[model samples]
Target: MSNITTAPFTYESLSQLTMKEGVLELQVGPAHAGSGHMRILVWVEGDTVVKVDPDIGFVHRGVEKLSEDRLYVKAIPIVERPNLVDTVNANLGYIIALEKLLGLEAPPRAQYIRVITAEISRIISHLYGIAIYGIFMGSSTVFMWALADREPFIDIMEELTGARLTYSHIIPGGVRWDLPKDFGERLEVALKYLEGRVSDYEKIWMNNPVVRARAEGVGILSGAKATELGVVGPNLRASGVKCDVRKCAPYSVYSDFDFDVPTFKEGDSYARLLIRVEEIKQSISILRQALKNIPEGKIIYEDYYKRMTPLMKSIYDEKGRVKFTSLLTSLSPPKGQSFSRVEGGRGEIFFYLISDGTKNPYRFRVVTPSFRNLPYFTHVMPGHKLADVPVIYGSIDYFPPEADRR
Candidate 1:
């Protein structure tokens, strides 16, 4: 190790670091500065930012460590609590990795359930993004509107899964329950309602002059830069690229669905916002199709669902709560590593699972969308006014702090 000397710093140290040297100091809440409220220190020599040291740990929850003591099955719900906006994506990613590790796969019907829930999750996630974007831009009307619109999707998930947000539905081999009575009918109606609501989102925020001004040509990340930064989902697509994990690397029953991946070339905050709005509509289309063609095969894998006792079956049929097969109590995956990435509402979410064929996982790692996208705050902050920080931050849809596996 090399010992080097660095200058003394402050909590709100967003001052002229060195006037003679032209070195500016950017105080990061969690990126730079002291860890009071998570600030970032942006030091500029002349026109470029030199260092972006993060001062985080403001809201550090031991999610990964908590999973280590918990059985593999128990970790599913706990791992998803940090990023509530995209719970389905988190649950699916973790379970898929576990399934791969254990050499198990959900049946065809179970896969369909995964797709429906995942797409619905996509809608809710985007709704949160747009609302956050709206509030940041001083447009509470759109925020209120988006939040209200999201309620129906949440309610649908509740009816189908017996819980609204923390849907610990997707387990190792398959989902927890079958759809409730008239499940398909409710889904179809919800999809239709969402289809109409999506258009309204566009009219209200996507292309509105004020929102566009705050976003257009702002924080423009080129296609190459986006890829280099390891961004994914609509964020990558906004840079004029046609890359979506669902279509390019189809998971679960996604390959069977017909949907378009919305992309734009502008590569700015505005473009990212518009791309997500378009993506929401595509999700509605998929939801409609999923319910329209839901088959009557055993809702869960026969190897699993067939064994459910009458008591368990009653709980499932009436409330759509899945009764787990006993095997989940101690999911001892093989002593190997598995990594899986899925398109989350914020961007691409990754899961790294290591098992020793024991009741608990040996090691687990996760990468959230906001954590990966934090670099945007540095690149876009300097050129704009001080007040525009939150607006741009909102436009980028920065999320709550999540766990870092290390």
Candidate 2:
């Protein structure tokens, strides 16, 4: 048997490994359906996978480095590109870190709006993950259904932020737009529709005997092993670890609402899949609370609100979105460092920012959940069958653009 270490495999070393007897190596694609924008190198003995290495960076965008070159406010959309399905959370994490450095806090109404959009983004991300998993598992029905279900939430976001996917809605002081007059009615309808759809998914997908058999005992990442490997998000929670950034370290207005962090002890592919479903339910609960108790006030911080020119204030009053002043272009923070973490749809999205009293940051670092979860490819796939690769990969919900952004 060949020994595989946690260290990443270089292309040259992998190319030279063909001389080994009894082990066949395979590349599961930068173009494969199951592998999106990345390749997985698999070594198998018969049907059993003996070793696996994930080759990420096919879609690397150098987000951290790019952030250093742009002004603080201009980097919002740049940071959001890595995780298009969960752009709000990515935008929020960066904004929070910038806010900390600037010593700014958004108003109560803005904080509540931030939570509402964030939970909506979480649902969108989870649905995308579930849809991809369905296709991987050969259930085209679930894939279509999950993807179709994301539209209503996307519509709501469009109405609020003027864009569907990469909504640079969250900024340093507050969100870009306030909830629309009819937003509550539309949100309630969407939430109720999703509630019914969740039940359908439970019957057609989650409880399917074939899915259960294929995933229940396969790719078992035990809680201890998951913790040791520094797994985050649903993968970590599925291993029975009660760690969630929202619950453990509340950000925005998360502390104001009540929501449960779903955990499952099984730690198998099935558990990882099931945890996302539960998280969607929790996100729904949070959205309801945020909408119900949202206070009425200026969406941005008072300091920035007061600084808005007469024309900017009138535009905000008429269109319900913030019009940035020239002051934001030259905005600079104190010379210091700050760290911020937010519970994104996948898990914890962390940002470390260093400002040198300049409009652009001195240094910017982001640790995406997908990047943190990459070790699972090496540690968890060793004993599984080669065919089980897609099942485990989908269950982990790894996004290569986000993982490769470093």
Alpha carbon lDDT of each predicted model: 0.74, 0.89
TM-score of each: 0.86, 0.96
Tell me the tens digit of each residue's lDDT in model 1 across 1-406. Answer: 0121222223333444455376766554554212224565556666545545555556667778888889999998887887787799999999888889988788887888888898899899989888877776778898898899899889989987777798988898888877777877887787778778877777776768777766666667778877776666677798877877777777788888899988898787788888878888888888888877777665565666566788887876776566665767856877999988787777778899988878898898888887777666645455544445566566667665552422
Q: How close is candidate 2 to the true structure, as a TM-score?
A: 0.96
Per-residue alpha-carbon lDDT of model 2 for 205-297, expressed as tens digits?
989999998888887877998898899999999999999999889988898888898999988889999999999999999999988899998
- Cα deviation at 95, candidate 2, in Å, is 0.5
Candidate 2 residue spans exceeding 4 A from truth: 1-17
Q: What is the alpha-carbon lDDT for the whole of candidate 1?
A: 0.74
Candidate 1: where is the Cα deviation over 4 Å? Answer: 1-37, 42-54, 306-321, 403-406
